[model samples]
Target: MTTTSHSNRDLRDEIRDYWSDRAATFDNDPGHKISAGAELFAWANLFRRHLGAANGRSLLDLASGTGEIALLCKELGFAVTGLDWAEPMLERARSKAPEVTFLQADAERTMLPDASFDVIVTRHLVWTLIDPKAAFAEWRRLLKPGGKILIVDGDFVSRNWLTRMIERFSGSTSHGMVSRHQDIVARVYFNRGARSEAVASLLLEAGFENLRIDNRLSAIHRAQAHLFSWRKSLLRRSEHRYAISASAPMTTKE
Candidate 1:
């Protein structure tokens, strides 16, 4: 988690406060929470496809608000650690899954030990990063040699006409916090949103390889569709969302 400053206060503080305020009701949104259902199975299936079997592998979930993804991975036999900047979100996460080691830390420079995890994962986090390249570099440093990273993100700002209309008709809303989205957007790297190609470039620059993209994100959308109205479901499924996976290079022992 990071922030931008204005009027003597940084965007970091603003974002932290905003998410903390929303922490209580965060799971109310369909995509935000994964309970027992087809949606949960869909996520498990997707992770299995990209990550193979968990097999007690150590995994880190960056920006792990409420720890849902961490818990899912844990259920799949991962030694999961959930990291976030918001304590309120971590608190909720802790209540649900005490076994996970939840840390309140910055995602960009976690300062955790090197070669600490076999896999790293995040969702909807890249677009908000002020220094995504730095974050990617840090993530690479954190992973063991030949480890993998799974990024679930999108260019949330740039939308087609149909998406715009659907969003407008759906009247989508955030956590009811003051609408500082544009203000934060102005300071972040991906103001238009974290498109796959742009992010792939960053990953390559950061020394990650084997870049793979999940264009449809069909499994997630299909699972979440029933939770919303028809308009909202269409909007969700039709959005330009995606997932990307990249690998840290293998190193030979000296």
Candidate 2:
């Protein structure tokens, strides 16, 4: 599908380039890399809560940067395929876990088969969408009947004064980043970062059912708490992070 960005200019190339350039340094963020420790367990627990038993089910990870979540799902016993538009990102992911399949492709239009996966998962991805409605519809097409999707993301653009102050005192994700990061952010569809409620409504309109939004990522937050200063921790608590889990219909909707 032709994706129309907020500016009505195709910003896909710019977005891809931005992430690709950051591929080398992407895992430096505590939350980005899940090696081992409480962080891994916390993430695993969250997935288990949402996905039930993996049981070797076919799972797809969209925009699977460095394959952190993809490898995590693999560890959880899911047959996983990760797709990312950036080759640098896929290269990192492939090196981390050669056993897991990593494909270079666009998440918005994966060019995969219909009903190809039992579960679909993505993190920090939805907010970058050029056309989220189309993306959600495509995800539904990719999932099997009764399949589930988990969207873990945050409203990074819309920060409160307290959160801003905390970030100012501590370090922000913008630290040690290029100017293009903000540039891409400004052009993406969710430029203002329309929190989880907006995403939930988009999913409903896309015909996904059994929708649920989780505002508290307390477990994951606690796991990575050590990485942040007290002020940063407060900022974390203040940030509009969330997960929205929804299931594809048991039967096709007209």
Candidate 3:
């Protein structure tokens, strides 16, 4: 194989292994699981408000760690499929939501047929990608005409004062494995440049239209001072950590 191909393969393996190692404790992280009714309601409302009604829609949750979003979508009556490369993570997801379809696949190059989904959603996944541009193209290809792609991610490498303060009071902590994985991912090309503006440009370059970014989710996160503090603490070791939602349009075929 060519050097570039080999390098990409190595990177993918590194990422997959990183996540596999963390799968056991992935949901144990306070920020990773939604245990409270109010939080679940908030998240459901957030998805509904952004993606519209989920019922009868075919939703693909890319990088669906532990099936969090996929389960939620299924609960809302959507035909949900969760895809991830890490087997351990998929195992957790399958255990949690056996009713939903879970597949082990790379987000950048899913083996599923084209134009198969009405909506694609992902959270905290972009930063872990090696080639987000390629992933966007694949996502667009998988999306049916007029379908939407909802991405929830943030720059964890550049923290502001307010975020730091929140971390201080929240007493949030991270495991060694999580920190190591974050550091490794932070060095990747897309993760290194994971700012909202940069990602928006990528979406446009990938042939998406009607692009929009809603930072209100970030505002909501900041507003929930207690939760935000805990979340911030877990992520404080990583740089460029800030969350936002980005959506874009896909033209319907004639």
Candidate 4:
């Protein structure tokens, strides 16, 4: 049997409770849902286009709080399992979309069977992870032979038009600093820049192939938020061929 230390379990519970309170306000607030409308739509479209066909596809939505993206996937014709460690968030998600399966589970450690999903997606959950490579590996384990994993997050060095607009509209560097701080302090997520790269690298190390990054430029032009997408490779034999070295840890700050 596997187990987590009591302290660690307590910490996880605390974080989950916090997010539950924040979830309802998350989308309504500007800072919370910056790229939500256009950027998220683009991401969905990108996934649809590359996904080839969505009817009856099995999807794993990691960190699936309140079931926003999972609901969208169900609407788009995919069978989705919404996973999160928070009961409150999962409860809200269930209330909103009872048709979807919402499970309270850890993103890093899942109880699902291996090679079970066609696509695995997580949004803005990179920073909170202590070991993203391990998280990716877990997702990889749950993905089928020809499955794909999509991660949506932001990079520090990669700034789009909306960032510039925010800087201009805010006027003072103080305002920009506030925005930056939000990225860092929000429930322990990694800030932009190499954090996103580190995530992709982790997926690559975990036997994922054909990795693609989409930094939302079109939405940025539309005065929307900046966003990026990381896609995993789909090949049976190729997974072993692409595994990241377990002996040497991958570091983003390094």
Candidate 3 regions exceeding 4 Å error are 161-179, 218-254
Badly placed stretches (over 4 Å) of model 4 are 1-11, 31-43, 156-194, 220-254
Sort the predicted structures by lDDT, highest score first. Answer: 2, 1, 3, 4
Worst 10 residues of 4 by lDDT: 229-238
Give the per-residue lDDT of model 4 (tens digit) for 39-78.
Answer: 5675467566546568788988888877777887887789
| lDDT values, one for every candidate | 0.87, 0.89, 0.77, 0.61
* Structure candidate 1, residue pairs in collision: 3-11, 3-12, 4-10, 4-11, 4-12, 5-10
- For residues 178-244, could you state the per-residue lDDT of candidate 2 as single tens digits? 4677777887779999599999999999999999898768988988888866776787778889989
In candidate 1, which residue ranges exceed 4 Å CA deviation? 1-9, 172-178
Query: lDDT tens digits, residues 118-231, model 1?
Result: 999998899898788889999999999999999988887888888888867765455345366667777678987778899999999999999999885787787788788898
TM-score for each model: 0.92, 0.91, 0.84, 0.68
Q: Judge candidate 1 against the unseen true structure and give its global Cα lDDT, from 0 to 1.
A: 0.87
Ranking of all candidate structures by their TM-score, best first:
1, 2, 3, 4
1 or 3, which is superior by TM-score? 1
Q: Of 2 and 4, which scores higher on lDDT?
A: 2
